[model samples]
Target: MITRSERTLNYAVLVLFSVIALFPVLLILSTALSPDEIGAGGSALSLEFGNFAEAWEQGNFGSYMRTSVIVAVSVVTLATLFSVMAGYAFGTMQFRGSEVIFYLILLGIMVPAEALVVALYFDLRSVGLTNTLVAIVMPQVAQSVAFGTFWMRAYFRSSSREVVEAARLDGAGHWRTLWRVLVPMGRPAITTMIVLMFMWTWNEFLIPLVMATDESLRTAPLGLAFFQGQYTAGTSLLAAGAVLVALPVVVVYLFLQRHFIRGMVEGVAK
Candidate 1:
């Protein structure tokens, strides 16, 4: 069914796109491994391992890595739990105010994090939670839960409603039905949400920076900002730090790629 010319053109386009998309990643990897002492003389092609060595040491990445990991894990866990709970309620439980609550939650997407950050900072200051890991993680979790609840709710609505009814017929309560039935069936969508929330939280900068001034509480993005601010110019070390921050998320996505694609496709199908 494929013509030779068309096939050739497709291949050419794919190759072009692959290069365009991957060039930055390749550049990051190269810079991450380049010699720190090379100091702009070293080409990306001739990168050594010294750049990462210096970056890790100078950036205090070990501590940043720990803080980032803690924040990301906490945000993802809390957000997913809250989202799933609310999604189940909206999708199954009947209530007069369901539509209103759902729409209000959906409105969260319209509100930019930056717009509310000023008020959020002062509110946290009043509670004396500023400059703490909780300050960063709490806001990110709330933000994640907002959209996450909507995503899962749509899936729950369009997904196997019959199964839920069957569970109820079998005397399963709401919690039991969600855990035993919807959870397993919703794995594809849930996995996709997890990947999304994790990526967003991992890369989120503004809230973490504004909420937590302590270096010890900074997330990867916040630390990256500080690092960039300290460096304040074109340098491979900052690029290497970015590489370090990006690798984990990239690795996880590669592993869950199937679920990610499936979630989107199934979501659209529904």
Candidate 2:
């Protein structure tokens, strides 16, 4: 089934992309481990995450990391619950203006965050939520709902309906059928969504910047920005902070690699 030219072409493409993707990561890792004032000397210098400890202490990234975890977990948990319910209803139930309302929600996926972010700022201020962790978590939860709902709905749409129908005929309530039958069958999709949501929310920066003005509430990305303010210190610390900022995401992707692949396959099949 394999032709030499075709196999060579595919392998060549993969190798090229692999290098493209890995180049930046390698650079970051090199930057992170470089000696103090390393980046200052030249771009070609070989380095590692040597200054990470100093950067960690300087950024107090432990606290920042904790805040990020709290906000990300909260947003992922809340969004997953809301999106699953909304998606299930939209996928399976008939309701007035369901299509229209879903289209409005879909608009969120296209709308740039910067466009509505100013309005969001004022609205949160009006509610006295500015500078609060809740402010950051809330909007992310809302935005995540759109993509997550669309994804879950796609999977649910392709799924077998027989189990659900039989449960309904056996007097199982709608929620019961959804919880017991649908969710179990949709594990692959759900796992994928969870990983995606966690990654997005974890990396989110703009909303947190606009919302959590308190120094203590600042997340890793925001904290990185503050960490980079060089009027007070050198850039080596900043490189260290960068390594910390990227570490958790890399670890998660590596661990959840299997679940992520299954989710993508299942959702595409749907």
Candidate 3:
């Protein structure tokens, strides 16, 4: 059905965007591999692979990575669980004040984090949670849950009524139906949410920056910022640190990309 000209045009557009997306990544890799001893005026084509090791050692990435992993996993796990339950309740179950409560929760998604961050920092400080992993994890969990609830609620609402009826007729409890019936079928959507939440939590900066004063509690991005500030002249090392911080996110996306794409497509079609 497509003409040759249209096909060529599509290919051209795809190739153009592909380069646009990859150019920065290639530049970073080139810079990271360049000799760390060279000044900023040096070309970025050297093969000094030891830049990553030097950056890792100098940046104290081990602690930063550990903190990031813990915060991200905790946030995603708690957020996903809470979002699924709230989403199912809002999407399927009818009750008094359901709409009001759901809207209240939805406001969490609508509100910008930047707007509430100062107040949130004060609240956490009042509770003596500052400079702790809990400070970083809790706020992100709330934010992720807000969006997750919205996403899962849409999925549950659009799911087959026949399946719900069958589960009910079999006398399955709400929890049973959710876990045994709906969840298995919702793997794509759930995985998509997990991948998204992980990326967001891993890359989060503002919360950690404001909440964590301890050098050991800094997340990867925050640590990278500090590393850049301290090592302004170490261009190759800075690039390597950037790559190290970003690598986990890339790995996670690659692993869940199929499910993430399928979920997004399905959500759109619905």
Taking the tens digit of each residue's C-alpha lDDT, what string does model 1 give over 59-142?
877677789999999999999999999998887779999999888888886577898789989998998988987888888898
Q: How many residue pairs in model 2 have overlapping backbones?
A: 6
lDDT of 2: 0.80
Selected candidate, larger lDDT, 1 vs 3: 3
Q: What is the C-alpha RMSD of each candidate to the true structure, in Å?
A: 3.7, 4.8, 3.9
Residue 225 lDDT, candidate 1, scale 0-100 = 75
Per-residue lDDT of candidate 3, residues 1-270 (tens digit): 899999999999999999999999989888888776554444344346577776777668877888898898899999999999989999999999998888887777767779878998898889898888888888889988888888899889988889978998999988999998998988878888888788778988899999999989999999999888887644888898889999999987788787657555553421
Candidate 2 minimal-lDDT segment of 10 residues: 41-50
Best by lDDT: 3
Off by over 4 Å in 1: 38-50, 232-236, 258-270
Score every model by TM-score.
Answer: 0.87, 0.83, 0.87
Q: Which prediction has more favorable lDDT, 2 or 3?
A: 3
| Residues 192-254 of candidate 2: C-alpha lDDT, one tens digit per residue | 899888888888888888888788999999998877774344455676787789888889889
What's the lDDT for residue 197 in model 1? 81
- Which regions of candidate 3 fall more than 4 Å away from where they truly are? 1-10, 38-48, 258-270
lDDT of candidates 1 onward, in order: 0.81, 0.80, 0.84
Q: Name the lDDT of candidate 1.
A: 0.81
